[model samples]
Target: MALSWALASGAQSVTSGHRTLFVTLSIVVTLVTLGITLWSRHSTHTTGQFYTGGREFFAMQNGLALSGDFMSAASVLGITGSMSLYGFDGFLYAIGFLVGWVVFLLLIAEPMRNTGRFTLADTLSLRLRERPIRTAAAVANLTTVIFYLLAQMVGAGALVAVLLGSSGGGTKDVVILILGALMIVYVVLGGMKGITWVAITKTVLLLVVAAIATVLLLDQFGWNLSHLLGTAASKSPQGKAFLSPGLEYGKTVASRVDFVSQAMALGFGLAGLPHCLMRVYTVPTARTARKSVGWAIGMMGGFYLMTLVLGFGAAALVGPATIKASDPTGNTALILLAQAVGGRPGSLGSTVMLGIFACVAFISILAVVASLTLAASSSLAHDLYAAVIRKGKATELEELWAARYASIGIGAVAVLLSLLAQKMNVAFLVSLAIAMAGSSLVPTMLFALFWRRFTTKGAVWATYGGLIVSVTLVLFSPVVSGSPDAMFPGVDFQWFPLGNPGIVSIPLGFLFGWIGTLLSDERPDPAKFAEQEVRALTGAGAY
Candidate 1:
C-alpha cells in the first residue's frame, strides 16, 4: 500500500527508488497492523479483559508487552535520532532509560502488582483514609499521562509530515487528530488485551528492524564498530563524543553538571511512571511481574546497545549536512540515515528501511497512546469514580462504561494540550513527564511499599510538594522560558537547567513526606500494614 501510494504520488519516479521502496514497505506494515487490531476487537469485552488481559497473561507475554509499553517513539526513534545527532549525549539517554528498568524490577514491579487492584492509585490508597491522597495521586498520574501523550502526539505529527511529504501546520494538526482517534479505539474497544498484543507485536518488529539495520551497517563497514566510531569522531568536532560522558561536551561547568544530573534524574525517574507501573498489574502473580520486569530490563538493555551502533552509523554514512537538511525537526535521524544507507530512491534496501521505520513509528505511537489512555481511564474510573465517588458500590459494568467514557475525554484533552504545546521539543516534553512522575509519585510509592511507618498525611504532602516544585521549575525552565533567548526576546531567568527537575524534585518529595509524617499524630494502622506487606511480598492479593 505504501509502495502504491508512493508510486501514485509520483514519489517513485521523482525521488530515488530507495525512497519509494521505503514508503511501500511502510504502507504494508500499517495495513497489517490495522487488520490485526480490527480482528482482535471482537474478543475484547469487560474492563478486566480490556485493562489487564483478564489478568491471565503469562510472564513472557507480559514482559514483551512491558517492553512494548517502554519502547515509545522516544526510545525507538528519539534515541536513534539523538545518537545520530548528539553522538554520546544521545546514548546517555538510552543508558538512563534502560538502567532505570533495574530499579523498577528491584523495587516496584512485584509490589505494585500485589497491592494495586488495577492502577497506581489503588495501591497508594490501600492503607490510607485520606480522599485527598488518592486525589493527589490521581492528579500526578493525570499530569504524567497528559505530558506523555503530548510528546507522542508531537512525534506522530512529525512522522506524518515526513512520510506524506507535507510540512504545514495544518498537516500536523490532522495527524494529531487521527492518531488520537486511533488510540481511543485501541483502548476503548480493544482494552488491555488489545494494547498488550499490539505492544508485543510492535516490540518484536522493533527488535527485528534494529537487528537488520545494525547488521547491514556493520557489513557495510567491514563489521567494525570501532572503526565506524573513529570515523565519526574524526569528522565532527564532537570527537569521541559517542564514547565519553555528556558532561565533557558541555560548554561550561554548570552546563556539565546540569547535563549529568539530568541524565541521572531520568534514570531513576523511570521507576515512577504511571503507564509503566500499571503494566505490572496485568500479570497474574507478583512473581510473574518480577520476572517480566527482569526480561524487559534485558531486552531493553540489548536494544539500547544496538542504538549506539545505529547512531554512529548514521554519523558515519549520512553526514551531518544531509541529517541537518532532512531532519530539520531533529526527529528524523533514523529515517535520514536509512535513506543514506539504502541508497537513493527505488532500491530494494531503501524501500525496506523506509517501510520498517514507518511501521515502527506508527506502532510505537499506537501502543503508547493506548497505554496513556488506559492510565488516565484507570485513575478516573477505578481510583476516583468507583473507589471514592461511589465508595465501591458501582457494578463492574458501570466501571467499564466509565472507563470507556474517561478514555474518550482523556484522549480529547490530550489532543487539545498537544495542539497547545505543539512548538515544544519532543524530548524535552518527555523529560518533563518523567520528572513529574519521579518527583511527585516515586517517593510516596516507595515509602508505601517498603516503609511500615509511612502515613497517609505524609503521602499527601509528599505528592503535592513534589508536584508543585516540579511543575513550577519545569514551567520556568530553559525549554519553556526560552533560555539564552526568551520565548519573547530579551527575557532572562534560568530557573533550572536541562529542562528536567526530577533530580531536585524527587529529594524534595522524600523530605516533604518525612516532615508531614513527623508533624502528624497518626500512626500506621497495624492491620492494614500487615495486610499490605503480605500482599506485596507474597503475591497473595493481586487478584
Candidate 2:
C-alpha cells in the first residue's frame, strides 16, 4: 500500500519531542473548543440565535469570523508552500484571494444580508412561490458545502498524520473520526454564537502567527526582500524566478495556467460561498454589513502580504528538494520551513515556533469545519425539512432540533468521504471545491443580486447545469485520474491541463443563466421587483 508507505515516511520525518508537543496542543484545543460549545448550548435556545447569533454580533466581530471562515489550512499552509516552491507565482494566490473581497464589498455584501435570512435559498425564493425555487437553491447549496467539507476533512487527516509522525491509513482514519465528532459538537451545541466567537479568536491568532513568522523570516536575511529575490532569480534558469509572467523557475506552462485559473476560481467563488454570506446576517444593518466587508478586506490583505515573506523565506533557506519531497503533503511545508529556520526540531526556538504554527493550523481547521457544518445544516433543516417536507409548519424548537441532527449526519458523511480520499493531494481537492463553487453558485448569486430579469426558471436551470458541468469535469480531470490506483483503478482520461475547471465552467455557468432567463415564459411583477431591488441596495428591509 502506497498510502501506508506515505504515512510511514511522514512518521520518520518528525522528532519524538515535536510529536509529543503537537498531540498535547491538539488535545487541549479540542477540549477548550468543546467546552465552549457546550456552554453556548444552554445560552442559545431559539432558532434565531442558533443560525444568526440573534442578530446581535458587532460588525468587527463578524469581520474577524469572516476572516476565519475564508482562511483555511489551504490558504495558511498551501499558499505558503506554493510561494516557497514557485517564487512570486505563489503570492498571486494571496493577491487573488484578498482582491476578491473588493468584489464582495462592492457587489454582494450588503445586498446578500438584506435579501436573505439563514441561507441563500431564502433570498432566491423570497419572491417566488417557494417550493420549486427553494428546492433548487438547496440542491446547489448542499452540493458546494459537501465538496468543500470533503476537502477540509482530507486536509485535516494529512495534517494530523504529518504532526503525529504516523503514515498508517488507520491513523489518518482515526483523526478524521475524531475531528468529525468535534465539529458536530461545535455546530450542535455552540450554534452560530459559539462558532462566531471561536472563529474570531482563531483569526486573530492566525494573523499574529503569520505576522511574527514573516518578520522573523525577513530578519534572518537582513530585512531585504529584493536582495532575497535577486539571489533566487540568479540561481533559477531564465532569470524569471521573481518575474510575474511566463513558466520559468522550474514550473511548466501547464502549471502556470493551473495557478492562474485556480486563483480566479478562488477569488470569485468567495462571494458565492453560503457560509461566508451567512455571516453577514449576524450583523444588524446593511451599513454594518458594508463595514464588516471593509474590515475583512483589510485583515485579509495584511495576511496575504505577510505570506509573501514566508514563501520567499522558505525558498531562500529551505531549498527545492525539500519541497519536492513533501509535495504529497504541502501543508507541512510551513512546518518544515519553521524547523529549518529555527535550527533543529528539538531546539528551544524551533519547538516554540512549531507549537505556534501547529496551533494556528488546528484552529484553521476548526473554524472551517464549523462554517461547513452551519451551511449544510441550514440547507437540510431550513430549506428541505421545514420549507418542503413540512410545508413551513414546523415549530421553532423543532427546527432547532432538526438542524442539530443534520449537523451530526453531515459531519459523519464527510468523515467517511475524507477517509476514502486520504491518500490524495489536498491542493487538488481544494481547487476542485473552489471550481464547484465558482461554476455552480457564483453565477446564480451574482445574477440574483444585480439582474432584475433573472427568473425562477433561470435560477433553477443555471444552478443545476453548473453543478452538473463542474462536478463531471472535476471527476474526470487529470488530478483525479492520476490519483493512486487504490482510489481509482484503470481510469486514464485527462480532459483538462489544469485540475480546476473554473476557467471553462464559470463562463458556462454565466451563459446558462443568461440563456435560461431569455427563454423563460414567466416574468416577475415589475413593481415587486423594483421594491426588492431598492431594499437590497439600501438595506431598508433587512430587519
Candidate 3:
C-alpha cells in the first residue's frame, strides 16, 4: 500500500528506487500492526480488560511492553541525531534516560504496582482525600501526556515525510491525520491488550534492528573500536572535540547548568510518567512488576549503548552537513546512516536494509502514540469522569464509553498541536516533557508513598504548583524564544537563562508539598497511613 501510494502520490523529488522500497516496507509493517490491533479488540470486553489487560500479562511480557512504552521515536531518531551532530553531549542524554530506569526499579516499581489500582491518582488517593488528590493528579497526568504526545506526533509527521520522500506539500499534514486516527483506533478498540501486544512486538523488532545495525557499523572498521572512534572524530567538523563533551551543550555556566538540569529531569522524571506507571498495574503482583522493571532496565540499557554505533556511525560515514541539510534538527541522521551502511542507493540490498530500518522507526512511533492515548484516555475516564463526575459510582460500561471517546478527543488535540510544533526540536520537547513530569509528579508520588504526614492539601499544592512552575519556565526559557532552535524564534522575549528548569522546579515541587502540609491544619490520619503502608508493602489489597 505504501509503495502504491508512493507511485501515485506525485512525490517526484524522491525518484530513487530505494525510497520507493522503504515506503512499501513502511506500509506493510503498519498494515500488519493494524490487523493485530483489530484482532486484539475481541479480547477487550470489560473495563478491567481494556484498562489493565485484565492484569494477566506475565512479568517478561509486561517488561517488553514497558520497554516499548518507554522507547519513543524521539529516543531512536532524536538521540541518534543529537549524537551524530553533537557527539558526547548527545550520549549524555542517553545515559540520563537509561539511569532513570534504575531509579524506577529501586524505589518505584514494587510499591506503585502494589498500591495503585489504575493511574497515579489511585496511589495518591490511597492515603489522602480522594476528590482533591485525584483531581490534581489527573491534571498533572494530562499535562505530561499532552506535551509528550504532541512531541511524538510532531516527530512522527516530520519522520513520515522524510521516509515517504515528500518533505513539502500537504503530505506531512495528511500523514499526521492518518496516524492520529490509527492511534485512536488502537486505544478505543484494542485497549490495553492490543496496545501491549503491539508494544512487545515493536520493542523486540527495535532491539533486533539496533543490534544488527550496530554490528554492520562495527564491521566497517573491522570491529576495531579505536579505529572507528578515530575515523568518526576525523570525519566530524569538531575533530577530536566531537569525540568529547561540550559540542552540543555546556559552553557557559548557564549552559552547563542547563545540561545538569536536563540530566536530572531525565533521571528522576521518567519514573513518574503516567503511561509507564500505568504499566505496573498490568501485572498481577508486585513481584512481577519488580521483575518487569529488571527486564526493562536490561533491554533499555543495552539498546542505549547501541546509539553510540548509530550516532557515531552516521557522523563517521554520512557527515553532519548532509544530516543537517535533510533536517536541521538532525532527526534524519539514522535514516541516512541506514542508506550509507546498506551498500548504496538503488541497490536491492541497500533498499531492503533501508526499508527494514524505516519499518522499525514507524512501528516505534505507533507503539508509543498508542500507549500515550491509552494513558490519557484512562486517566480521564477513571480519575475524572468516574471518580469526580460520577462520585465513584460510574458503571463499567459508562467508564469504557468515556475512555473510547477520550481517546479520540486526545488524539485530535495531539494532531493539531503537532502541526504547530513541526519546526521545534523533537529531543528538546521530549526532554522537557520528562522534566515537567519530574517536577510535577515525582515529588508528590514520593511524599504520598513515604511521608507519614503527607496531606491532601500537600498533594494538590505540589502537583499543581510544580506543573505551573515548569510550564511557566519553559514558556519563558530560551527554548521558547531567543535562540535559533526556539519554538518562537521570530519573537525573542526569553526570560529564563536555561532551557531546562528541572533544577529549580524539582526542588520547588518537594518544597510546595512540605509547606502546604505544614501550613494547613489538616492532620494526618494514622488508620489511612497504616492501611496504605500495608498494601504498598505487601500487595495485600492490590487488584
**Backbone clashes under 3 angstroms, per model:** 16, 3, 0
lDDT of 2 by residue, 121-193 (tens): 8778766548877888788778788877877787677677777776667777887898898888889889998
Of the candidates numbered 1 and 3, which has the greater TM-score value? 3
Tens digit of per-residue lDDT, candidate 1, span 1-543 = 000011112122224444354457656765665666677678666767766878888888888888888787677666676666677776777777776888888888888888887887788788876477778888889988887888888777766565666656787798789888888888887788778888888899888888888888888889987789888776655666545656233668766766665766776678888888888888878888999988888888888888889887877887555555555333556776676666665577676677667768777787888888898888998888887889889998999899999999999998888887766656566777888888878889998888778888899998899889887887777766655423333565665765567668888989999998898888788899899999888877667
Better of 1 and 2 by TM-score: 2
Residue 358 of model 2 has an lDDT of 76
User: Residue 404 in candidate 1 has what lDDT?
Assistant: 91
TM-score of each: 0.92, 0.93, 0.95
- What lDDT score goes with residue 77 in model 2? 80
Full ranking by TM-score: 3, 2, 1
TM-score, cand. 2 vs. native: 0.93
The superposed Cα distance between candidate 1 and the true structure at residue 519, in angstroms, equals 1.5
lDDT for position 325 in model 3: 69
lDDT of 3 by residue, 1-543 (tens): 000011112233233675677678777877887888889889888889999989999988999999999887777877888888888888877788777888888889999888888888889888788889988888888989987887777766766676676767387788789889999988988999999999998999999999998998899879998887787889887889988889867688897998888888888899888889899889889999999999998888899899878888888888888776666666667777887777766566567777788778778888999999999998899999999999989889999899999999999999988877666655556656777799989999999999999999888899999989988898888878898767677899988998788899999999999999998789989999999899889989888
Top candidate, metric lDDT: 3
User: Candidate 3: where is the Cα deviation over 4 Å?
Assistant: 1-15, 420-428
Overall lDDT per candidate, in order of appearance: 0.75, 0.76, 0.83
